[model samples]
Target: MIPLGGAAGRVAGLVLAAGAGRRYGGPKAPVFLGPALRVLRDGGCDPIIAVLGAGARRTRAVVDLAGVQVVDNPGWAEGMASSLRLGLSTAARLPEVSAVCVHLVDMPGVSALAVARLLAQAHASCLTRACYDGEPGHPVVLGRDHWAEIIETTRGDQGARAYLRRHAGHVTAVECGDVAGGYDIDER
Candidate 1:
């Protein structure tokens, strides 16, 4: 079991909110950003980063983004990988950040409890992902050691799927279905 408190290391929260939401008809940021940030904050993550694109202006206008470190991703249309890279890059610059817990704005069902579980299990050398009913899902915790490889292999909308699959053996899947729903709000 991972040790508690100070020895656990620092984990930054990265919310990928830059999606175009083509199918959902508008920006998801207005609907999901607040709760996502709250979950990360309440779950023990510091310096949360929210990547904005597509409807950034409107998102900023509608959402009450108080404590988050907002970063605009001009290449967001390229897809999730771009936002992921942006968030990771921003987090990596902070010397205190040892890992990042990635969350998607569209997934409002991912609770603070699930995020806490993921953060609680985090390790500087391990890639921990939240799973729903044994199926791997989001709020993925990626150690600093894996960021470079993930940033290199990720493309299009796949995010870190390719890199995770390539190093599946190193991942520790934690069951979070009981605490959170791993569903994406992709459609209206």
Candidate 2:
């Protein structure tokens, strides 16, 4: 794990793969977990954490989660918020992890380059994310300073939307459409 970050900090990768993916016919985590993990690893996140829900058993059976910390979210059916809280709570235990780059499993177009660009300027207090042609996208880099509030405000499938919107002015948007696409897959 690379414990390196700009201005002295460690950024952990948080993969939210707990969704049931009903529209996609099944859980997308088992199918795309590997690629998502590679994205964070190659991008520069250390001590990655992947939260599995719906197909937890199947995902674990087929996916290779050797180095990454696999977190099973029993309340995953509640929503993405549960996975986010669980992942962030796990990250909070690591004193070395100063921030987390949150990525979604359904977003296959999101590349390591996009994650790299976001992590390039990450720190303990920086709120950054990838923007595709001025539109906000995934791979949101959340600083440790804002975790408590995010965990409190997020509910259901909202994730960190409430917190991000509340502090939009402080969030830094990094244009990554040049290197990757931000489109998420919803159907088979």
Q: Against the true structure, whose lDDT is highest?
A: 2
Query: Any idea what lDDT model 2 has?
Result: 0.90
lDDT of 1 by residue, 119-188 (tens): 8877677799999999999999999988887887789998999899989998999899999999999898
lDDT of 2 by residue, 1-188 (tens): 23234524778999999999999999999899999999999888888999999999999999899999999999999999999999999999999988999999988898888888888778889899899999998989999999998887789998998889989999999999999999998899
Clashes of each: 0, 0
Report how far off residue 80 is in candidate 1 (Å): 0.5
The 0-to-1 C-alpha lDDT of every candidate, in the order given, reads 0.87, 0.90
Model 1: residue 131 alpha-carbon error in angstroms? 0.5
Off by over 4 Å in 2: 1-7
lDDT of candidate 2 at residue 170, scale 0 to 100: 96
Clashing pairs in 2: none
